[model samples]
Target: MENKSEEKGITRRGFFQRILVGFGLIISAGATGAIASQLLKSLMPSGWFGEPYVYRKVYAAPITEINQVGASIIFEDKANNRKAILINNGGNIQAFSLVCTHLGCQVFWEKERGKFLCPCHTAVFAADGSVESGPPEKSLDQYPVEIKDGLVYISFREPTWQPEQYFRGEGL
Candidate 1:
């Protein structure tokens, strides 16, 4: 009888120890999660950082030789998944973003219509980057092109919302 009583006590103690260990593990895991969440929140940038400004050499072709009047040659940014167009309007070289401002669809130049056409919807932009038809209320984003040493250069930055007649706005 004495041996049986001692055995029961030992089992009860072991059971209690296992329960405590499980509860401790649960609490530790919860704490780890809370700490990780706090750390991630702290590391995130406050508000939106200004769009990254970048300058890239687009093509080596001569500006005067390429006579793509209504057609545009597309250049892709693999890092941000954006496309730009280099248009040769007569002898002048201009670059416009292929991304439609309304719904983010890629626009293609239509030679017959002499405009930039979006296939997803019938959005059209005029020869000088103005949105003439469709849902796009703003003009096509333009990049300043500089030609030097027979190489074409284009400057691009992250899309920013600018107020009317304002170079630097509160949103940017």
Candidate 2:
């Protein structure tokens, strides 16, 4: 047989080996770029990718409204058609929706009774928004609260967090 390497110069084995090296370098560069992109995303501010935030921090009320130790500031999220309460319960601040768990009626704070009273069905909730008695099977829905820039903010969770809502067309 003829010696192909000594004549043709480009050996098949060497060509394949060089092609494999090029492929490996390309893959390595792609992987490195992917990792660097993810790292840069981590350093960027939230929602910088032009996506909606997981939870929108809506301005609820002014911090000055929460003055007394036992005072509560009621606020409405007009865009959402929902109402909530921001209470300074002896310095332990908290907030939750006023919607009744049973039939979606509005609940009111009865400070005299130190509990929430649902007028539609007389369902009673404890001071901490837990179901104390009546027709409701669950407690009131609580939300995350934040204090910044001399204002109080309530975090309204996006519907995308619950996948089931999309199937039911509720998230639409």
Candidate 3:
């Protein structure tokens, strides 16, 4: 065996040395991968992959088109999986979440009654989101409304920072 290895130019010592070097390279590669993963994680922005709640413009309608007071317009936010009601009350525009506070049922805009009525439990919320009747103890959730450039933009989430102009309507 010794003569055969010597003829092949590979000694027992060299074989063990190559095995150790192979293990060292494997260990170094693992360490390098770990370091790179940590570096990438630190460099990435916070909440980049997380579901951070953000105030997004859910509905936009021209002010001139909203002409009727006490009339409610329903806007569904598919991105946030929620619904909102935009009401023009005496020229003052306001928005409220359509999810009933009592049992999370979808509430309907009762234009005749001038309130949001949840048919699930008969919970009634006034146009101002105040509780009118039924099992609901708290008022309906109100979203912030911004009127910019003759357009009404409604946001369902509370913004962490100042939101940029969402509705840019040159002809609208």
Candidate 4:
């Protein structure tokens, strides 16, 4: 009888075609994955990849625009994953971290009281950052300030990825 196995088996040409198709699929998948990765990265906001533990100018505003004492400006440092507050304290400009020393709760400037207040547990901090009252034993972290020409600039150490650890209060 004729070879039954040969009749049912793939021919040499068919085997090669199958192999080429498999390789083409793999290549296409790899190319698509690479393109998708690039597209996602491009859609993210700038400075999302900033390195930790580096000090940088977090914010700048015109001193002339402050208008009044106790007026404050707040902003997020995306690179550091932290918040900051800049206040005009009686003609003296100052900047401080908004993170409360007690439990990392964000603090806010009380323009009427002229101090930073932590609403989490009623923790109160003077505009200079000293803890006025509450459970916190330490003062709020302060950032170095620079006045250039007509603008105010504040510099602070960028927060790291480590949990519950920050460079702000460590003399950075």
Per-candidate clash tally = 0, 0, 0, 0
> Tens digit of lDDT per residue, candidate 4, span 11-86?
7777788999999999999999999988887775233585357567745678776748767887565654656777
**TM-score, prediction 2:** 0.57
Whole-model Cα lDDT of every candidate shown, in order: 0.72, 0.81, 0.78, 0.78
Best prediction by lDDT: 2
Please give the lDDT score for candidate 4. Answer: 0.78
**Regions of candidate 3 where Cα sits further than 4 Å from its true position:** 1-52, 158-172
Let me know the TM-score candidate 1 reaches against the reference structure.
0.56
lDDT for 167 in candidate 3 is 35
Candidate 2, residues 1-172, lDDT tens digits: the string is 2434776687777778899999999999999999998898877634355546367678888888886787887887565555788888778778888889999999989888879999998999987889999999999988899888888889875543444556779879
What's the C-alpha lDDT at position 21 in model 3?
100
Q: How close is every model to the real structure, measured as TM-score? A: 0.56, 0.57, 0.57, 0.56
Clash-forming residue pairs, model 3? none
